[model samples]
Target chain A: MNKTVLQIIRFVVLVLFQVLVINHIRLGGYVHPYIYMLFIMLLPFNTPKWQLLVLGFALGLTVDLFTGTPGLHAGATTLMAFCRPSIIQLISGNQKFENIPEPNLGQLDGMWFFRYVLCLVFVHHFALFFLESFSFRLIGQVLLRILLSVPVSVFLIMMILYIFKRERKRE
Target chain B: MYNLQRFILKHHFVILFILLEVISILLLARSQNFHRNSLVNTSNVVVGKIYEWSSDVGNYFRLNTANEQLAEENAMLRQQLSIVYDTASCVYDVNEGDTLYEYIPAKVVNNSTNQANNYIIINKGARDGIERDMSVISTDGIVGVVTDVSRHYASIMSLLHSKSVVGVRFKNNQEIASVKWQTNNYRYGIVEDIPTHIVLQQGDTILTSSHSKIFPEDLMVGTVEEFYPTAVDALNKAKIRYATDFSTLRHVYVIKDLHKAETDSLKAKFQ
Candidate 1:
């Protein structure tokens, strides 16, 4: 499949999945995993900085539209996009992104890919929860939410990667 | 001029990033402005419709609890009806002019108890005569007040909301105070402004007062769980365990007071 077309399909599927299914899983009112950040993470490595920011904005705003919070998702996801390049560089040392079309489990080594996804997911959830609460009083609760959500989101994202990689291998 | 253009070209990504972030923050600020803008909320048509559909599926999981609640309420109502009817006298002592309130049953389509100002979206709306400030109650106890409405759905500001305050008093003494949610825990609320000298017991029941037209007088609010008096003024402040278990809430009745408009207008004249 064409990379652009594939990314587009992934965007739609992930957004629908996030809003329809994951949003309803109110486990003990504490953990709400946002796996839609995986969409931003899976974008082509050589994608322009400006395009990445815009895509991130669009992704976050779409989520906000569904979740009823206007700007919480947008701010956090945009920050994630801005920090992505730095995180990729710091995680995968010396290997330039120019040769890498997309960052997936297929091309990147398992340990580095896991680290990269973990760091970015952490940043995304941290920013998302803090922006949603926007309060110093419930800082403890907000931190707990982020702590509970990060691992779940990471595991879900990696599962998607594994499934997609297996499908590609079969093709 | 060339140097400036080069700088602009080089830093445009950073500029764009900041610009988008600023726009997002502005949107966040606008939505949280608390002016009760109905247009931007989740209870609007598209989102509400989707939630209504999903809730249909989710409701099945909560069926057993809903059934139990209904049965308990029915038994209680049967006992109350027996008292009101006075079976010994078939003619009864009830008057025709005593009707002051009506109720519309609604299904809870979407509810959240985790947020600071939690809102519940119910299947009822303006078309069903649900309007802002109408009181919502589950079979168990007081739920919240209607805050926003679309044609097909309405949003309720749940009692768990930080801004939610209910005028309440001890059932035995009729000593009035207010209850507000000060913590994220959905089961509890804080009581404010009770006189220090007012006697309190740990298990004393609290009821809604006639203080606001939003809720009817003497509706069940909660039971006192703890009491702490201030040192200087020595006012009785305490914690209450809410009667309605919001986590298990599925069905509720939106109370429509027939005399609310008249009372509100008359009160407005004095103000």
Candidate 2:
């Protein structure tokens, strides 16, 4: 599939998975996995920062629609996308990440890509949990939820990236 | 001028990011009205049906636990109901033919307890004897008042909420005070406006006063847990630990008295 096709497929898969699948994966009737950030993580390295942010907003808004939380997810995801480039640069130091297809753990290596994904994921989740916790009393709960959810989200996203990479190598 | 235009173009990504974030913030601040299309909302009929199906599946798995709860509740209700109404008075469950006919049951369509203007939705509405200002109470105690009624649903203010205000009184001496939830305590309330002269001893039972036409007289509110004299006002206050568990409240009843409006108007005229 071409670039547009792949992006569209990613969008559809993420939305369906979030609404139909991940929602059912209830841990203790609370904790839910958000694999929707795959869109931000897989953006092409040199894609205009504008496109990345828009994609993030769209992804977040779509999830919010399903979950009945209007801007919570959208703001967090957009923030993640906005900071992705800087985070990627930090991890891939001296590696000019212009062309070589965005976020092929093969191109950036495992540890760097993991850290890159981890930083952006933490940023997205922290913003989200903090905003949702408007009362300011539940700081411990908010931090704990963020800490627990981020690693799970990142692990799922990395597994997806790995599968895609292995498929690319076979091709 | 060309460089300035180039700057705008070059840093346009930052501008776009700012714009999107601003929109997101605005939307976040005002989320209650953002469901314009209603297509993706849980309130939508299609989405409601989908969730209903899933909840049904979950309900199946929860049956054993539900049965255990029901059995325990049944014995408790039986004992209590027997005391309230002896075997000679009546004895029948909610699902029974005769008892079911007396009360209109409604499914909770949508609900939120975390807002200033919190409301609970029941599937029954105007056509189903629900109207504005109707008294809504669970088997436990007062839940709230019906505020809005649609063709198929009605919304009620939850008593657990900070916004709920109901007429309350001291069960023993009949000291009237309006009960408003402070949100700090889930199962307690600050009953205000009791005169300082009237002694408030701890463990004093409070009940629904005749101050409001919504709650009938003598319905239990709670017992006084603590008392303090607020310096700002002449009246004393009591912290009432409520009898009912407001959080686990799932089902409620909307009262429709045979002489409701007539009795209210007559009492209003006297007042």
Best by DockQ: 1
Chain A TM-score per candidate? 0.94, 0.91
Docking class of 2: acceptable
Error of 2 at B85 (Å): 5.5
Model 1 stretches with alpha carbons more than 4 Å out? A2-5, A24-32, A163-165, B1-9, B41-43, B87-98, B229-233
Compared with the true structure, what per-residue lDDT tens digits does model 1 show for residues B119-156? 78888888999888889998878999987788888888
| Tens digit per residue, CA lDDT, model 2, B1-271 | 9999999999898988888888887777675441223233334444344444544565577678656755776798789876766544555453344431134555554444332234565667777877777777655566677765655556566675544677887777766787777643456778787887777889988778767767766766777888997778898877888766654444567876556767779979998
**Sliding window of 10 residues with minimal summed lDDT for model 2 chain B:** B33-42
- When superposed on Cα atoms, how far off is each prediction in RMSD? 3.2, 7.1
Give Cα distance to truth, residue B22, candidate 2, Å: 2.6
| Cα displacement (Å) at residue B240, model 1 | 2.3
Q: Which is the leading candidate under lDDT? A: 1
* Per-candidate iRMSD: 2.4, 5.2
